[model samples]
Target chain A: MKLLESGVVSENRKHIISFIILAATLLLVFPLVFDIFRLNLVAKYLSLAFAAVGLVICWGHGGILSLGQGVFWGLGGYCLAAFLKLEAAVNIANEAGTDQIKALTTVGLPDFMDWNQITELPYIWYPFKSFPITLICVLIVPGIVAFIIGLAIFKRRVSGVYFAIITQALCWIMEILFVTRQGWTGGINGITDLRTCLGWDIRTQAAQYTLYFLTAGLLLAVILFSKKILSSKLGQLLVAIRDMEDRVRFSGYDVSNFKIFSFCLAAMISAVGGALFVLNVGFMSPKLVTIAPSIYMVIFCALGGRESLIGVVYGTLIVCFGRTYFSEQFPELWMFLMGGIFIVVTVACPKGLAGLFESHGAKALAFLKKFLKIENLASKDKKEVEA
Target chain B: MSSTDYALYIENLTVSFDGFKAVDDVSIYVEKGTVHVVIGPNGAGKTTLLDLVCGKTKPTAGKIKFDDYDLTTMHEQDIVQAGVGRKFQTPSIYPSLTVFENLEVSYPKGRGVWGALGFKRDQEVIDRIHEVADMIYLSDKLQTPGELLSHGQKQWLEIGMLLIADLQMILLDEPVAGMSVVERKQTADLLRKISQNRSILVIEHDMNFVREIAHRVNVMHQGKVIAEGSMETVEKNEKVIEVYLGH
Candidate 1:
């Protein structure tokens, strides 16, 4: 009881409870309840949850509204997909029987490159040939991009709606680049036919199960990592920056540097999600790296309660499930339904599902406590009369 | 006066907003370990002078030297790191943070990105926060969120934030503008206590508070300093009485 009364301890207890609940659902219940196919879908959703978590930090806490998270996500997805596709092409080349087939396969070009009739591979794609390099690229590429962007705008003190618009434009530019450079980027279809990673076939049901657990595990780790950041003084500074930017500046902090750190951190986390996404779904498409999907990612964070890490995981799950269910049942109206839900959530509960739970959850607990106290009193009175 | 004996030395400080000078040729020298108050009428650019010294507004021409550091060339945070602190006209505490957090963030350490992330709330930091809170009369409200604080409490909290930074020089812009009589008296006493070791430059309109705390006073009229002396000397000056005190 004394431990529970301590604010920090109780807050930590709540987080631990939420984490355990999420872990139980993702690791145990979902795998048992759903078949391999449905489980794969959950993996896909969890992958996107990475971006949602990043948004919780960047947008919710730091007050940096990035409308182009998809760019970082795509950066991660493409980095891994490029590596996997190169390996698959190498396997094909090794198995080629005819000289004509051998000539194309020997070049070690992705299929899209061949389709474009490019005789030589682009120098940019060389790094992807090495798996280790690809892994490093997945993390750092997004961070570097975010760093440059952050330095340019944040240092200049350009933020709020302008920053959001700039990010949206960046997403548009990436989409266009991906679509036009069909030879390099697989054009509109993106990099597909990823058969294996280091000779481990990813298409198998066993692989799918392993990938699901990996995604869940990674998501939990990301949550814990984000929690660490929020628990630190840096986290308090972020909230302080959001509320009073100038005060933070005058308090001897380089406010722009903190903002840049947050933006870069968010981008890196989203990129990790993107890499996992490619592994689960076996494709990285230009379609995913556009403004619409990027906005949807923001919606996931907003609906989940941008401030709550656990809430965002639930927000991602609920929204993704809704997307699948609606698309299946009302394919024509699903888009409208999703839009309506976002508007409703924004209007009715601006703080998202986490806010709703916080306000109502406390009241519900109090009511339960009162009911238990009354029951205990009646039982004590009966015992006394009997004695 | 030699620059070494003064904590802040402003010379030929001029800031023009599209040809109209908000502060024109304003020069004031604040001696080390003294409370210097700037008293002026509305539109007299008293606040603007503080803004120029603190790097909130850049001077079109002239030098602002704070203990050998050229404040005119420094950024806002760098100026702060150079041992100078400024409080705005309004209370600017982080509303969501507790009174303790408000002071802790201002504790001068962990001013960098990585530094803040690795900063530990050790006994030293806690002790400093409690000490500042107690000084601001918010010791009992350490855990209370800043937004819940009364207006006077918020003002004190902002002052406490600067106190925690332990800056060598402090600039205060109307620190007691909206404060009640009791709150103003507390602030006057707080200023006198804090001014023992450091230099303070305050812009205030209250004559009683000014007289109570001002070790030296500069009276400004229409973007320029008209008189400089002790409170009684400045009050007795014919020019100061004609332009400001008469109104």
Candidate 2:
């Protein structure tokens, strides 16, 4: 017998269908409706959504608000950027021919490095030359960093506002370091003018569309994976820790390991998003890895429902799109409008847009059922109302 | 010193905050398969002694051995993994989770990262949850959010959480602090029933409840064990009377 038909459709089946519909809309409907330019913009936003999703788990659910998520995102972004920059440099080196390459001395260097008067590739950028190594670093670097942070803080029982403050400070430190180390990190401008990934021209319109679909596919997979984690016994443990850490510790569970796991998982996911952001946007910069952006990442998760995974995705898209539109349209009032939304969301709707939908979604469904004249639906709702 | 005879052994455990000693020179031993109760006045450091035993609070000077392992320097979770469970003074349950989930997370099946991710609610887990729910008088309230349970039920649920795992030593701090008369009586009976195989260290103040369940009672006063014997004997001890019962 089908599980949905076993009279348990209201909870599990409804959620599955909603997730499926969301995936379809992102994968199919958006591409069909929006032009390549708009779709590409969406891909960029979706990459940011990855960070927000991490916040949904780490901050929203686990109750560990890391204001330094941008540090991980930047690490992942830089790893990919360094590889692509090297690849572009290699292509330039080959095109210049052996004699010209010798004369130029900057033939093997990325243009920014050459402009900065670097004679040889730095030791740090050497590992990024290999795609496999860069790929591994994209996930591992962030995961290890998060693990270390989780260990230091969680083990010592540092949490809540203090953890948030520390993370924010870390984000600031990363931004300053990246910006000041001009020869290594390309300074304020960041690594830009990326032409290809491996040999394929990522700059072309067709490639942008392809990357959009890839981003969409990856986002859906990540959402499904997160759903699985949230449904598992581990997810419950996280919530238990969030509610009562000491109680959980005394219950025979290693609470810090769970916290570290969640932190690393969130970091790895954000790292993936960072990689995709570089692919879609064709640039990596200190701007994206600063304290302001990190806080914005958390705001996206807050606006999406912290407890609701799908709600977080929708929240990211809405906030990102709203930011562009509001900034472009009302330039001066954008920050004010954003501040107002934050206040309203926090005070009036603490659960964000998802909470708003939940309160009225059932009524809307019932109204739809009545309008469509679906047999037995309105009657059941009416009976429930009477009761 | 022979760990086989005592499930838990503590010698000269002392914890001081600044110049003041919260738990000073407190020595205790619990025999396997017996319910040992610690009765004291409000500031007699009953909770602190339990804290020292469970590794929640580090001792300034002491040796705490559980079975054959030294626990004074171990982590709280490590101490727990060594088969010790602690219930706090107030009901410290996951309020948002259902009573079943609250117990299931502590079921000791998937204690590690991968184990928890792939943990299944098999027949054994289901059977255990049902058994524990019934034991706590929460069989009908399995689906209820833990926060919504009555004061007595929440207390029982916290104790039920401790039983979900495989534990040899259980420490309960004020297990029936705010319970009604009937709930307290029921709890006294429940403790006696659960203590058949495991060693229990309970910090309690109610003398009547202590007399009802304690196989051996220790009266503490001013961070010291004033008397230790059967409930009848300890009640008659002049020092215990002067420091605790007289008050």
User: Over 4 Å off in model 2, which ranges?
Assistant: A1-10, A94-102, A378-387, B1-3
| lDDT score of residue B72 within candidate 2 | 83
Residue-pair clashes per prediction, in order, are: 0, 0
- Per residue, candidate 2 scores C-alpha lDDT tens digits across A1-387 of 132123234556557877998898898899999998899999999998899888878877788989998899989999999999889888888877868786866766888877788888999998898999999999999999899989999888888999999998889898899998888998999999888998999989999999998998998899889988987999999999999988998988888889889999999999999999999999999999988888888888788888778888888888888898899999999988888888888788898887887887778888999889985978886564433
Residue-level lDDT tens digits of model 1 in A7-72: 465567668977899999999999999999999999999999999999988888899999999999
Note the residue pairs that clash in candidate 2.
none
Interface RMSD per candidate: 2.3, 2.9
Error of 1 at A88 (Å): 0.9
The collision pairs in model 1 are: none
Per-model TM-score versus the true fold: 0.95, 0.95
Per-residue alpha-carbon lDDT of candidate 1 for residues B138-200, written as tens digits (9 for 90 to 100): 898886799999999999999999999999999998899899999999999999999999999
